[model samples]
Target: MPPLNYGTFFANFNLEMIRPFFKERIAFRRKAPRRMPSLAFTTLPSLLLLGSFTFFLAPPARARLTFHPTIYEEKADYLDTQTVAVYHFRNEGDKTVTIRKVRASCGCTVPQLDKRVYLPGETGVLRAFFAFGSRSGKQEKKIRIWTNEKDLKKPYELILRTEIPRAVRFSPIFLHWGRGDTPITRTVNAWVEADSPVKILSIDEPAPDFSVRLQVLKPGRGYLILVTPRDTAKPKMRRIDIQTDFPRKKPLSYSIYCSIR
Candidate 1:
């Protein structure tokens, strides 16, 4: 106690103070059997699974042009030589697009567009002019368009359909006979469409090798032509013209082919 071991006294005092704190911590840990799980380990797999489902199952967003009423159908008059088809479209995308080309299925159908480039939300029109040009009955045409859209695998197609009325129709316009066959007469039938009635006026003089006669089944509506080869001894061919009274810039005419083979 006189010179007193001060170092030993301080060491023993520090050990007594820390020992109780460590003892309490150890007793608390021993009383708890299971530790609380980490939120990271528990929720990470669920979040990962939800993210995978959203990535795989969600529909992709497309940025491209859109067309309204992609198909058009109309009835063309009998006298109409040409008609126009209109298509309205818009750039329903986030970026600008440029139309590369426009093509038609046939030469008679011509496609027209105003400009090549279009901005987002901008709209435009495409017109296709189809010329009948002696074409009749039901007609179908397709116009294809190419664009610089990233996801476009094939060209966009626009369809045009129309039924053209015919002024006249002929059945069996061609008649033929074998070289050594019977010289029997073959009949040709001609009828006018109800919408456009035309009278069969007269027949042009046929070749000397054939004989032609016309009998009007119904005046201005229907007719029958009887044709016979004068002689089937040798090969010969003749075209007989049937004149119609249908008023036009040039008189309407139809032809029948007669051949001996």
Candidate 2:
């Protein structure tokens, strides 16, 4: 920046190595000391370097694979377990293309490709596996695909959308034990298949006339409840509110009715 001193910059080079251009630049600057020095000498050296970096910045190349459901968005009434959503894609290009790798947004989601390479017009399936262990509500996931497409440095993002419902199904919400019949324990099973493992947090407090116990077939997902009337002698009504860990608006509760007839 301080006027490039040839003696300091080109000190290592021998005097005989000096080009005619450097001599011409020195003579021209000497003659016009009052005028601004031309930076043309520096521009010429830059041109020589530009030859090494002459890659033309161009548009992004075309993709070889075309997906059937380009964007996967589906609503599930209930996603009880880890689910895999598959996307069908074909090599639309005339040439073969290799899939280098497939990645997902999170560890909970994984992308699976059958093979590395695919021939032209060959169909391939991309399976996106989503694990919803204890999560509920609307879930959105993304999968990034890397391929051998020319000039394609950035990966393609595939979007996935799912809606998980608050899933707790009770076979019979209402139970009755007749007065004349011998009192026997009645069972109600609460089956839950959900991203969030559901377990009964607690049952509503003290119903003196009723006896209730819970049985867990599968830790969080499946539950069996035993409800018995203390004595089926008189008419008695007990309100059994079942609470679960499943995500819900408030209280996170399911209701069951118990009555003595």
Q: Which stretches of candidate 1 lie over 4 Å from their true place?
A: 1-45, 56-59, 177-184, 195-197, 229-240, 247-252, 258-261
In model 1, residue pairs whose N, Cα or C atoms come closer than 3 Å (at least 3 residues apart or on different chains), thus clashing, are: none
Give the Cα-based TM-score of candidate 1 against the true structure.
0.69
Q: How high is each candidate's TM-score?
A: 0.69, 0.43
lDDT of 2 at 22: 94
Which segments of candidate 2 are over 4 A away from where they belong? 1-60, 167-261
Count of clashes in candidate 2: 3
lDDT of each: 0.87, 0.80
Candidate topping lDDT = 1
Model 1, span 1-261: residue lDDT tens: 388798998877857679989999999999989978898998998899999999999888574878877998999975578989999999988899999999999999999999999999999999999998767799999999999987888899999999987678878888999998989999988888845568877887576888888888987788888998888999988888888867554556778888898
Candidate 2, 106-134: lDDT as tens digits:
89998888888999999989999888765
Superposition error at 185 for model 1 (Å): 3.4
Task: Tally clashes: model 1.
Answer: 0
